[model samples]
Target: MAAAIMNLVRVSDPDTIVLGGGVAGSANFVERIRSYLNPKTMRFVSSARS
Candidate 1:
Protein backbone atom coordinates (compact mmCIF):
# COMPACT_ATOMS: atom_id res chain seq x y z
CA MET A 1 0.00 0.00 0.00
CA ALA A 2 2.84 2.34 0.78
CA ALA A 3 4.56 1.37 -2.41
CA ALA A 4 1.43 2.04 -4.40
CA ILE A 5 0.93 5.44 -2.82
CA MET A 6 4.58 6.20 -3.37
CA ASN A 7 4.27 5.39 -7.01
CA LEU A 8 1.29 7.69 -7.38
CA VAL A 9 2.92 10.54 -5.50
CA ARG A 10 6.14 10.17 -7.43
CA VAL A 11 4.33 10.10 -10.72
CA SER A 12 1.83 12.85 -10.03
CA ASP A 13 3.67 14.99 -7.47
CA PRO A 14 0.67 16.49 -5.79
CA ASP A 15 0.79 18.87 -2.86
CA THR A 16 -1.82 16.95 -0.91
CA ILE A 17 -3.87 13.76 -1.04
CA VAL A 18 -7.53 13.89 -0.29
CA LEU A 19 -9.10 10.62 0.77
CA GLY A 20 -12.86 10.48 0.67
CA GLY A 21 -15.66 8.13 1.70
CA GLY A 22 -15.06 5.31 4.18
CA VAL A 23 -11.31 5.57 3.76
CA ALA A 24 -11.42 8.90 5.59
CA GLY A 25 -12.78 7.42 8.83
CA SER A 26 -9.53 5.99 10.15
CA ALA A 27 -7.25 8.58 11.68
CA ASN A 28 -4.71 6.01 12.88
CA PHE A 29 -4.71 4.48 9.44
CA VAL A 30 -3.88 7.87 7.97
CA GLU A 31 -1.12 8.37 10.47
CA ARG A 32 0.26 4.95 9.63
CA ILE A 33 0.24 6.00 6.01
CA ARG A 34 2.05 9.25 6.78
CA SER A 35 4.61 7.33 8.80
CA TYR A 36 5.27 5.02 5.89
CA LEU A 37 5.49 7.94 3.53
CA ASN A 38 7.40 10.90 5.06
CA PRO A 39 10.77 9.50 6.14
CA LYS A 40 10.83 6.44 3.94
CA THR A 41 10.07 8.40 0.81
CA MET A 42 12.95 10.88 0.96
CA ARG A 43 10.93 13.28 3.10
CA PHE A 44 8.80 14.33 0.15
CA VAL A 45 5.55 12.43 0.49
CA SER A 46 3.02 14.73 2.09
CA SER A 47 0.32 13.49 4.46
CA ALA A 48 -3.13 12.63 3.18
CA ARG A 49 -6.28 14.62 3.90
CA SER A 50 -9.85 13.52 4.59
Candidate 2:
Protein backbone atom coordinates (compact mmCIF):
# COMPACT_ATOMS: atom_id res chain seq x y z
CA MET A 1 0.00 0.00 0.00
CA ALA A 2 2.78 2.41 0.93
CA ALA A 3 4.75 1.48 -2.16
CA ALA A 4 1.70 2.09 -4.36
CA ILE A 5 1.22 5.53 -2.82
CA MET A 6 4.87 6.42 -3.41
CA ASN A 7 4.46 5.35 -7.03
CA LEU A 8 1.42 7.54 -7.40
CA VAL A 9 3.27 10.53 -5.99
CA ARG A 10 6.22 9.99 -8.26
CA VAL A 11 4.02 9.69 -11.33
CA SER A 12 1.43 12.36 -10.56
CA ASP A 13 3.63 15.00 -8.99
CA PRO A 14 0.65 16.61 -7.34
CA ASP A 15 1.01 19.84 -5.42
CA THR A 16 -0.63 18.20 -2.47
CA ILE A 17 -1.57 14.61 -1.72
CA VAL A 18 -4.28 13.94 0.84
CA LEU A 19 -4.46 10.42 2.13
CA GLY A 20 -8.19 10.21 2.89
CA GLY A 21 -8.67 6.51 3.54
CA GLY A 22 -8.61 4.53 6.81
CA VAL A 23 -4.89 4.82 7.46
CA ALA A 24 -4.85 8.47 6.44
CA GLY A 25 -5.82 9.70 9.88
CA SER A 26 -3.25 7.73 11.82
CA ALA A 27 -0.49 9.71 13.55
CA ASN A 28 2.10 7.04 12.82
CA PHE A 29 1.15 7.00 9.12
CA VAL A 30 1.18 10.77 8.99
CA GLU A 31 4.60 10.85 10.61
CA ARG A 32 5.85 8.22 8.20
CA ILE A 33 4.81 10.36 5.26
CA ARG A 34 6.34 13.47 6.82
CA SER A 35 9.57 11.65 7.37
CA TYR A 36 9.57 10.03 3.93
CA LEU A 37 8.37 12.85 1.68
CA ASN A 38 10.17 15.97 0.63
CA PRO A 39 9.03 18.96 2.72
CA LYS A 40 8.75 21.07 -0.42
CA THR A 41 6.28 18.64 -2.03
CA MET A 42 4.25 16.90 0.65
CA ARG A 43 1.85 18.45 3.18
CA PHE A 44 -0.23 16.38 5.60
CA VAL A 45 -3.53 17.35 7.16
CA SER A 46 -3.58 17.18 10.93
CA SER A 47 -5.46 14.13 12.17
CA ALA A 48 -6.18 15.90 15.49
CA ARG A 49 -8.53 18.33 13.73
CA SER A 50 -9.85 15.98 11.07
Query: Worst ten-residue run, lDDT, model 2?
Result: 41-50
TM-score of 1: 0.60
Give Cα-based local distance difference scores for all models.
0.68, 0.60
For every candidate structure, what is the RMSD over all alpha carbons to the true structure, in angstroms?
Answer: 2.6, 5.1
Instruction: Give each model a TM-score.
Output: 0.60, 0.46
lDDT of 1 by residue, 1-50 (tens): 56777888789987876665676568877777667765756477443344
Best candidate according to TM-score: 1
Q: Which window of ten consecutive residues has the lowest lDDT sum in model 1?
A: 41-50
Q: Candidate 2, residues 1-50: lDDT per residue as tens digits?
A: 55566678678765655678778879887777657655544344222233
Query: Runs in model 2 with CA error above 4 Å?
Result: 33-50
Specify the highest-lDDT model's number: 1
